[model samples]
Target chain A: MSGFSATLGHRSYEFADLRVLLAKATPLRSGDVLAGIAAGSAEERVAAQLCLADVPLERFLTDMVVPWEDDAVTRLILERHDPVAFASVRALTVGELRDWLLDYDTDAAALSAVAAGLTPEMVAAVSKLMGNQDLILVASKCAVVTAFRSTIGLPGRMAVRLQPNHPTDDLRGVAASIVDGLLYGCGDAVIGVNPVSDSPARCRELLDLLDGLIHEYAIPTQGCVLAHLTTTLRCMDRGAPVDLVFQSIAGTEATNRSFGITLELLAEAHAAARELGRGTVGEQAMYFETGQGSSLSAGAHHGVDQQTLEARAYGVARAFDPLLVNSVVGFIGPEYLATGKQVIRAGLEDHFCGKVLGLPMGCDVCYTNHMDVDQDDMDSLLTLLAVAGCNFVIAVPGADDVMLGYQSLSFHDAQYARQVLGLRPAPEFEDWLTGQGLLGTDGRLVMPPARHALLADPSGRPSSALPPG
Target chain B: MIPDEWSALRAMTPARIALGRAGSSTPTRARLAFALDHARARGAVNEPFAVADIARELARRSGPAVLSVRSAVRDRDEYLLNPALGGRLDDASRAEVDAAAGHPGTAPDLVVVLGDGLSAGAVNDQGVAVALAVGDAMGERGWAVGPFVIVRNGRVAVGDEIGARLGARFVVVLIGERPGLGATRSLGAYVTLDPRPGRTDAERNCISNIRPGGTSVADGATRIVELLTRARAAGTTGVALNP
Candidate 1:
């Protein structure tokens, strides 16, 4: 038994070499490739042996890359670390992996990395292969929620948003989603509406309905109809309660103008709302939304990069001292981001930038269908944001923003985050939930007696939660 | 045969209605002219208003003193994204307006605010000229108008806060309207009674398309006086007071 003094320095093997290795090299035969690398002139052997992995690539790569003489090379190899790990994950049948992961319970970062490493097509394939139970088990295993100190608007607490959007301000559809969200233990932080109509009268109706619900149910949440500042101002003037002055903010003047918003206008709106005592819970009375691609979309980037422009938007939001500042990263579409990889990277960048700027940063972990993304992509981004101490995520029904036509986290998704990550709703909201007997001691919903009445009717009629129009 | 009607209409207005066609498409010349106008419109929206320069220009031109103020929007980017912000004065601008309220005998019946609404080109082109005509008309009417304030990055509602803060009964904000292909430099005068924040657009009377080609500067200024007089007397501007 002659031991070869192998000092492999290369970072990766060639694909053709890998293909050949996969076709011919058994575990025993894989040792032959390793031995070849160990012999004199290991670089050439390593290059050729990168092929012929009849053995699992993970096993093969780990064997080859981990023992490199240079630590830098080892780290570089680790950077491409997913292939080996992925190969191992790929080796398990859906049932086998699901059962194993259910009881696995370790640092979820690795599982997330594996999930992230798989392509959307691959993830879709896995989903199709797995039973419903197994798929859920795997998802729970993949969520990694680290305890983050600073929170969104409130300090040191995780918050969840309930976004009940309606195209025509239909009270029934709006109430149903709200009811659904509340049943899923949401809306303690903010129960805001995304209104398609820019009409002040329509907005007033939406605001009135939301305000009515908040009081009627004693739901501990702030409500806002994210209409234009002018409309919200009208709502206040008409003696309707304006909970939050919402605006889509941007970094540059031209872009902000494109959205029909200006910081000065926001100040005026804030002043109007504050004068009316709308934001009684906190000093800040505004909710601002921003994203990376808006400046570019509005043709107002001013030659600055998207991320820097996004940070500048945070600067604008901070200047207003807003209660909620959301960065809807991938909602813009593929013309700006082009792919989920880009979207995921941009989401992380925006979140980090907002957090650094001391913003109560919540990411709209979302993507439109036109963009190259899937549920798995959102999950990867969501898990990472949760780990990074994101304040809250938007919860629409079925992961679909029906009005905005974008895909975002659903209430069930929030449940998954809470259950698997040991996270809970915002503290004040949690207390209200517990006191109301909506949430149990174990951080799950207690099956409200009025659940059936509150949920949306299949006939598209208003549920019992819908107040008299 | 080339239509004589289109040429006649083209002679009358800059509107695209008179554009002649080449086999179901606009003629090459007409298309090029449309493209040129579109470019001008784009340029008008993108151009930055030099607030101090406009103030200097207005002050140098004569009549009332020009006081420079700004909307809550800090810069061009902010001014664009948040129209609500553009509708109110920033703290510094508010302080300036507030300080002006103490300027004895300067509290006039009308407060004129010159704003770069959507087109800086329009403000640069005709804002000062229009303000002068409006001032001359108000002077003849014996209405004591306050010093002119050039509001940088302002919307229609921006004048409300300026007027309220200045202790004026009326505010005449001459802002640039969103530019159209045929009219890149159209200026509009928005008149409000008892001006303050949260005044709806319907509460204001707007005189739009003030330009060399549209409403002449003198005509616009004259119409503003008419609206102002009616607004003050009627205690309203938009629906309640028809000028």
Candidate 2:
């Protein structure tokens, strides 16, 4: 139990232990060790009591710290270091910071950094760092030693939907990036690039735009650039929905409607791609984004009640299901926040239904801020994360070629020294690679980094010339 | 051009599609069947202890393989109430998949199962693709897979008895879905690492639906090898961390 000296002499109370913090406070039993605060008001009194005895309050409340000895000192430190997330936490020493990280999850460097004093600006930077909302920091690579490896022939290939007139910058960029990344990472496993534009003519324009890239770096596998999907079409059959918009309370229906229109248009565009014989045509779908029930109100918003964005998601998910067969499933982003209680309940249902039914949930989008996601956010998201049985991530190496090259294989902190910038091998599974004795003379693994380095410098550099440790 | 079934589908109007930069695709029952048969023929798994066979054996030997996984992986009450897991076994299930499957190394030429068969409609829709992919992969790799039976069940072990009967090395079971509120009738592939019936998740690998939200066929195929290889070493799947 913890309490602050808010009384200057207001009310003095004591607490026994904290496990019952969530429970309403009661009068202290004579010999029972209890903690409470003497405050100006009832809420203040409760808040002050919570601040005493160095209670692990961050795990409890973010806005309820009281002014007391440690609370006062902690608040001062928090003011200095910038503890803005939880109002309850004003200050933390190095040890406290470590404790916070341990509680928040230490595997994430950003979380640890935030515990050390992060600014709001840093939070924004982190969210924009990756394109995928799939599982964070996840990627895997494998070697394809033989030709014609067992690759299933899906009905189509990786498709990018383009607007009617021309391929928009977003479409082209996202498509090309996905293609390039896959090509580089998966190696010889990816097929050709395709597009899904609105109309037949528009689809043709998209292809025309890709003429150069198509000719320059085309794979032998068949692909498409489809368009002209005016009528709603089915996959393999007609009963299937092309899209699904499961929703909760409505908030900003405008955005939801817009998204719906855009998806319908997407269906049309896919039809165009198919008509055009583009291996890459339109086949997109999404799930609802909700935080509440399927009401028209701001039902699905988060914390501010919910992610007002969820209603929009639900609206969208409900629109294109069983109606159109093309699976355009997507997760609602940054809206609803299932609280701890909600998380447990949801987890129970998720586990029960998941085990009982084979229909596993798919796809989720996360909008991470620079300061690292609040601990509560992680708990809320876990409910959904657990639903996606497997990870389907978009590999984003960003623009740092060296980082990309390094990521092309794998590297850890210890391997950082061997890198010497862009000179060594960065093969993933370095442990296995080294064990297999597949390394450069410098004891590095064989990878694109080494090859790229050789291309730049044929002659070896002097060890003495290099910066000394 | 649209396939005849699509054009004639009860609900949808066959929309015109483009050939775009890539050529166009024409659909026909014959084409669909051919496509599926082609892929399956290509995947004839002659190698004993094929992934499918292992998955089936696990279910036969274990109390309930896929059901156990479904119990933990779902969030919704409906899905939890009727959970589904792919029905093939892997290398690890060998220790437990009914004494017959719980043995070591390769065993049958085929193993078939059902579970939400890919997603219920897969048998009717893209079943061809799954069949083709497996058959083609096995065949090209010098294995022989039969034109086997596909079932509609919550679990995928429906085909196991057949595998044991034929003395096949593998059994490829496909199941129908429990009907997702939104995306019902989708399909996925689960390959057991060992050809056993009593095995668990550690003994299998999955190749989910061909839809956008699911794992791509190509990606799924690649992971299957590693899954098979690892399950061969570990004897389990799912939560049993893969090395």
Candidate 3:
């Protein structure tokens, strides 16, 4: 392979390999700096971008960032390439691909037709060259929808994952938050809970709780207990009502090892969830969460940049035919992202890459307290992602997750996004809300009386009697 | 006014829920409450641990000698940025541990390390109380307990090196967990058997959320002692020994 080089009037820049060029061209983020692969100077970074823009898109297919022999993700991307779809844009350079994506002539059908041919490396490379608006506009044109109990990623639609976590995994505590979210018209994506304990018994209990609520209320949504794959598998074997098998995956095999998972293990879990056949609208039954810094956090980045590694994770998600995939963007602290600007940029980039790779991508727009971020930054990212047509986002009560120790979007925030953008929840969920008198004519929540059926106890009585509204 | 039904739901959990909306957003009171909690948790992350005061308290309550040590990280900023640096002792602290181990006639059965992890306030609030309780429990069992080593800006793995240097059969690290919006001063205890430098989190057992509103300090200490005893009997910790 030939070295990549670019020049200005006074100075010239050179990168030794494709990996080096890709890392140097990436937008400035703390993860690259921590990995010692980021460009040292601003001018050097621009020059690398210039050099990368001229590289042929075909070069990505020929040269892998992580070797195919060492990483299963690389093999998955290469082996699954669709030559017929690639014939449309196979001749374009990386810069040309960016222009092609942003062109008004490139409609949703055009992008969708070529989605199977575009590799993660090709998508991540083009994303590095585009601005945030370009990322949004391109992603907004592409549509990747999945369905289970609720349909997600449909045009003019959005969804929320109601996360009602408690310090001790208390049932009533979780139920209270669920009521709050339901009142605000959230939880269409999935009513998922991150259990404090990963024990199979606790997971089974949470799963049963969510299953009982969904069945009793006849809500048009799925229930998920966000536990380890092994733990979820154990619960499945014991006859638990498993809706979606959740796991955190990474780009490299070693990072997946650090998470105590492998491709084969994920495949097994995916097959088991499908075997249960629990979907009403569709059968996509896996939920995957990925982020930029997880590979580096596990000491398994293989000298690759975080953004590319994040894109590689989408390759893993696409293989499972997952119902939902999201990047918990700012949950990892400032060591990798460092600032709000970095977090916002990473959120856009991850969304664009995942959508282009033919996956129903969402985002957990969150930040740890220790990061230099606040709710305002979260608000900015949330609105941008909404405009970018994110399928769903996590909605915790008041945006404060007491058990996970992070701040995410609140139920009100999800409502605000839907109302402002003229988007509605999944059609089935919206119809159910209308039937329950919880949605007004304008598609806004109607605030049913204090004795709403959603608040009824499992025994068909009001759980708490309160004054009428 | 906050609705009666919303307020009724707040009693179920410490989680911030049922805050009535203000124009499709969180009400001002709920927003400010969240900000205040976040500020407190962030403050706890940067707050300096009172090592000398904690050491003094441990010495007064426990029979074993108390020693203070520092990790390779020089400040809170570096501690947050470079986590690998916080997992090992500095040169001076390594030498101190070696010298302290030389005077010991026989290897102690267990060593307790108190570390100021992400939340220094957590260790400052409950480190000594838990240490003294664990020491008393081990003493009653007639096991030799080594000196309590208080580590500054240390991670959970730091105890492995300290225990290996002292030639203990087991090591228990009582460290501060990352502060959350609900609990800022929460501590966690990690137990490892046959301590060494290359141990992973999968090879250790953890008991978390040790605070006033969460797990009480006394209960945390008792659980630690029981877990360590189980680890000794099974000759393992982490996933190998069922909780």
Candidate 4:
């Protein structure tokens, strides 16, 4: 079958024969005809031409010269982008930002700084205008350093966080999620729980249980009950086994005060936790969480942009020499960032800024219900952040963070990342998993010989069939 | 291009007063600006002050030193909820101020204190500028200035007790103003003569909106010093003392 011809720039080229489209019976323009043929073909020769040929994709789209404007072909060609939204984004510059994004060879840090310098709305709009190829080009060309920083108990290996949250402080329900994640070869960096009850005693009880789990399973994971520094300090005073001290920090002093945390207090908590020497694997014993919205939400941003303020919070977090500093990116609802596009851009900016600041950065790729997001949105963001060399990701059961009332990565999502991205759990935890016959030498997970007994009994004897570590 | 109808008007102020709308909604640019400003307003109200940090910064900037004090308001939460409590000093704070006042060379002809007020962020951003300007203006006029004091969980009137304790003839307070959408970093100055604990807002004269956009620090400082001079001569502030 004959395919259509189109003029791109100054050159005229013929598209390859779209083998599946038998006839061109319509009076559509060559672009529209090519789009329909592209949509209908098994080989997708026309679609390939649209990408591979010197087709001037941006120019063609910007000219608004579509013959069949209402057709699916036109929509696909435009990436289903909102015309008004794209126009607004394009109005910012004459393809300067797009060219910057397209220049994959540009320094990742430079690109990140540029990305961060943009307003959140600009970032969000640009991201919405990007096609799959544009995203891939951007993600692939960036540097990927394996484990730029490490948490305690994990050394130069990709880590996964197990967030076992429960509404009633039920250890059993929390244990179920933790066991599920652990069995899937997750929870290498830390097993941090967001507890529903704010009581120090209740948090201390959960910390004690995690301590027992870590020892009994010989899991190379530190435990943190995400209570306030004061609550965690009280837990320490009571001689509870607290592995990592946790605090919610913001950019400015006043914002920290509103949250009842101060830099001096953080320093004190860091020193107290360090003196306790609870973490067995690494020297650092503090963990911090920050987000762009907190400063504004807490009324302390000082009229500084949220990204800059967020970076300032990282400065505060890094001073404590934390084991892991995760940006709960979209955990705050839509008030600060209204859509998934904004959340993803903020996640990348946070990752880049945190990495630049020399902190072991991770992202709780999450969103509340009020935001314009879903599981798929989180999946896309999680994949991009992982590819951006994020230190760790939050792994909860079923992508549900019940206690926090948000959605995060699921245990399966962790496995999927390791499989697709060639990422591995923290080295020590990987060794433990292999010793338990749960992971093969190739780093792929294997069915346990005795799945039932292993989960039921944390102290169960190692199977003789287990691979020697 | 046709001249924008509001071009000259918009240049006069940062406030989005006469921005044209689009079919009953704010235009995209105007709406986004409004949102950003609204966010700034919210941020100012919610920010907390690390009083020690501000004091250390003040000490670094100049001499005399910086003293830390607290109001009767126990914490930021209480301070936000109970405006009345923020107006007075706590017992321990009173003792500290009195003890410090007893130290030799601590008393001065003028006492200045900075408070976190409704916008701690404002105080942090503009407090130092306004304070330096006031101090330099006072120094040039040959007025003896006391150590800079930073009070946490305090309102504007808390400076009265601080000034009275030090036995200064005049007290000047630079506090974070209640933020507006366009002016989150505005710091307000409250000047009083013969400072006492029971002084009310009516007994003090205010020079407000002291920031880059509203009132420049130099102008605000001059206003404060001028008000103080007049208040000292009149032996009063408020309606009785005119600049």
Candidate 5:
């Protein structure tokens, strides 16, 4: 293309045709930028090497509670990778196991390979982020434990979250559909469902549904399935103290999904601490987890825009309620910012334990060996997150979710929180980890919260960091 | 509007740019090929081509007085990633444009070019309206507009390069807008003073977009005359005194 204006002496550009342009085009947009950050490149590499023996996280969550399930993924992997058993494994069996892997697996590697790659630091982290399960069984058990120990401890917050508007797609809408709408959708695959609506308008509809079921309960809750919803501090109505989840700008970007889960626990505990401080001990759990745990999409990494930062700072300024985020999901991987680390460390040095916790969802391998964050200095960082008030860790059975994995193992955070904090054992932990399925019965470990004896108890006090003779 | 006399203008291929296969309906494929080839050929030799060249093969037009046009896009970081700054070549852009101008005193009448390397699709979506707006903006003073140029994979420099070459006293680049998720294609504008590449955004006068939200080129006509009149008076273009 060429041209020139005699008087103006200006040149003009031309195009030979349009079809050539179409040939060179392949629909492009900004979302594609997150293709790898969410779950890609790293998945393939990590999946190939995982083995059941290394699933460190799987072990701690259900240590002897209900029961454990056999490692279906591992068994299938073994049957294939193992030349001796390859032929013995039937096509139908492999297909079923493959389907299971698709449902539960956060990566592509075998379970044992996942374990072998872990460093000691990662093991501690995965072990911690193992709670926050949605299994009806675990939630009921934990609620009972928390209820019994109400006078002495703040058991664990049984938080739930849901979006108000039920969009057929995306994480927020899906979670909300199940929780508030009570309608089953894609959300059942990711988070649990609750029929409770926080919006006054929608709640009225729920109240109507409860008209017939009220034959036995007090505050109409027939259709109100307990769900988690997070709102900005400003959004909270001082009078009613409730807000829808999506409206709150917390974790708006993809990197801050943990904020939602942590908020869930904080909401519950903070409200209780205030009431208990005021001698209102029997206020019926103060609608804690019913409207907590609003997690961000954790889908994009636009690096904190102005809006995103404002939202985060706002959430932080407002102290967390102890009910939903009674526990936090801290970062032990590459995404951990110095800013976040400083805040968490201050909380720890100041000795605020019940407020937040860390579970190294993404271990070193997930970061570098796996290529997620590329942070060579991650091993030492894990120690810092732990020091910052992180109690439970979430490593795989024998493996650790490395940094390069990003949030590939983030789901494990809730697992460790529920398993370790609530003190439930194998079967219960197993049930939630793998869901209530046939395989949910094997290889579970639900180590109960070791209680301390008033007299000479090893359980009551933290183990002597003083070293054995 | 080749001067009523230099109408016998013949086409010439630029020394720096390579003409790819223009064997199709749209030149975009050829543009993309050029970019990819430049990148690949320059391989470890370099990472980014940083420069591209394409001349309008107008069958017949103006005389050959050898002119250079280019824009020094200041706040490079902001422009590369930001969709908002697409309207004008930043301060640094002016400096670069000035430097590229072998002769800055001889200003050209019109500087036309495409910009905001967002995407060709974005340009197609937003550029046309912006062009019309610029045209209307230039109409008030009865300042006659010449021809328009749209470059693919274009950044601010392409404007500077052509403006410098065309020898126009005034030049404006209607560029492509950055593509977001829902709004992938949009348009922008860039104007240059003295129609030279090295001059800064301050030296130039611009009413972006041939459409609203910008000084539509149609509306820009009167404004362009006013700017030229002011430049003729102030003898400069910068933060201090630009029309």
Candidate 6:
């Protein structure tokens, strides 16, 4: 393996290989420190970044992080490289790529045109050398949109995935949260639920509930039960109304194995979801969730840094053409991110990498109670992501997920993001909200009357509380 | 003010709902309420465990004798930073375990360990009650239950090493779960058969959310006993055994 070296003042720093260089160059995160691969000092990290900047971008194409034969994620990345798109930036160094990305001339169209030419490694390497502002600025210029029942990632638009989880999957409890989110104009991305159990029967019950609600109200949004792939496939086998097949994916084959998934299995699930023909606006049927430290948590990172590995997981997501790919950034706890600042940096980096690779990236800007983070930290990250043009964000009823036991943004937080940034929900969803009189002409959520129709019974009959509409 | 109609929905679930907004933001009272719960949960994680007091209380009960030990972790920061360290015994504690379980003759039928996991409040408040109840149930079943090992700053896998050293056939670890804003002092029970090192979560059966408002101590004890009985009959636990 070839070595990389740089000198800071009188001292020289040498990295043993490309993997080591990538690990040391990554900004401070606790996961790499726990993995025992982080740079020894701040100066050493700067040295590695200096060395990483001079490396030609083409070198990433040849020097694989995980061996090509040992990992299918690597194979997919290499096999799908578009040489025609690479011809334009063939000779740029990693440093030059950073400069080019931030150049005023590089607009959304320019970034989209070269999306296929870059691999996860190239993107991850360049991200290591960029600052947080640089990440947001470049990511803001790259637009990757997709649609199902509603559109996402469109310019001047932000969506919310209504996460109405219940501890026991009670239909009425879930219904209450759904009603809260709908009134606040917050389920445009998808009305997703993280079930307490992974059983097919339980998943089917929730899916039926969501499907029925969407149909009854004629809501311009899709529904997803975040269950395992096999469980969802079983639900589909039972002829349940399945809209999206969801799974948690990782960067390496070993980590994917720990998740009980493989590339072939994902392809199978993708084809199966498409065959159902449930999508009305588009065929992107996959929804994947990734994070910074999942690979290390599974003991499958192979000495690679967590941020780089996170980018590689984006590689897996892009192959499936997912409708939603979110990084549950802080839910993994303080072990990976450690503090509020670390979580904020990671959220921006993930959004930038996924968007650069041409995927509709969202963020679950959240934190577990055990971590040294709070709602204030979440507010910072959420505002930054909205500014960076994130496709969507996960919102619960009151920023408190009683079922999952974490703090995320509230439905009101999404409205706040959209309101301050001059962003709207997906067009179809905004139209639906307007028609239902939940959105005012001024683009703000109007408080529904004490007897709104959405608060009616599950049988679609008006409750006594509902006045004649 | 909350509308009268939302009362029915609020009563259905513990989730925070119908929190009236303040112009695209959480109302001041709702935000402050959430902040208070978050502070309580964070305090639960950082609160020190009164292990000595709990050990004395357990020893006074008419069940198994209580023995106290510590994991490899020195403090809360280390415990939060590197979880792998929390899953093993320190050298001194390992020696203490070796001296306590003399000669490793016949493996005991069961070993119950009380670990102060993320929330010390969980173990302090409910750990003794659950341990004594479980010990009594196991005794009624005519099983040889070893002394309860109260571990400080311990993780779930710490029971594996302690049980393996004591030569126990099965180990049940009653520990604090990661504190949630809604439930700060929630306890969990993890049962592993033929306890040893390197046992993954797939090799254990778990009963979680044991507290006053959640799973009662009596119900948790009954479930643990049932799982143990089934494990003994099937000669396995975890993914292999049906609970």
Fnat of candidate 5 is 0.00
**DockQ (0 to 1) for model 4:** 0.01
- Residues A4-53, candidate 2: write the lDDT tens digits: 23334575544332322211221111101111111224564354334332
Candidate 3 structure quality by residue, lDDT tens digits, A28-89: 98888878999999888899899889989899998999999988888988998898999999
Candidates, ranked, lDDT: 6, 3, 4, 1, 2, 5
**TM-score quality measure for candidate 5:** 0.28
Q: What is the Cα-based lDDT of residue B98 in candidate 3?
A: 89
lDDT of 1 at A138: 44
List the global CA lDDT of all models: 0.63, 0.29, 0.89, 0.64, 0.29, 0.90
* Residue-level lDDT tens digits of model 1 in B1-243: 132121221222122332332322235675466446555665787677877777887778766667898888877655554466788888998888787784756678887898988888898888878888888788788988787998888888889988888888889998887665456778989888888887887788888889887789888888888888777677777867753
Docking class of 5: incorrect
Kindly report the TM-score of the first chain in candidate 5.
0.24
lDDT of 5 by residue, B53-88 (tens): 222222123222212223333443333322223333
> Which lDDT value does model 2 have at B222?
48
| lDDT (Cα, tens digit) per residue for candidate 5, span A269-367 | 445334433222222222222100122123232332211122222223123322122212223211221123322322222112122111111111122
Better of 1 and 6 by lDDT: 6
TM-scores for the candidates: 0.46, 0.26, 0.94, 0.47, 0.28, 0.97
Off by over 4 Å in 4: A1-157, A451-453, A457-469, B1-243
Q: Write the per-residue lDDT of candidate 3 for residues B18-68, one digit (tens) a residue.
A: 788766677888889988998899899889899999988888887888889
> Worst ten-residue run, lDDT, model 3 chain B?
B1-10
Docking class of 2: incorrect
The best candidate in terms of TM-score: 6
Residue A204 accuracy (lDDT) in model 4: 79
DockQ of 5: 0.01
lDDT (10s digit) by residue, model 2, range B120-183: 3444544444554555565565554443443323355434433453455545544443222223
Docking class of 6: medium
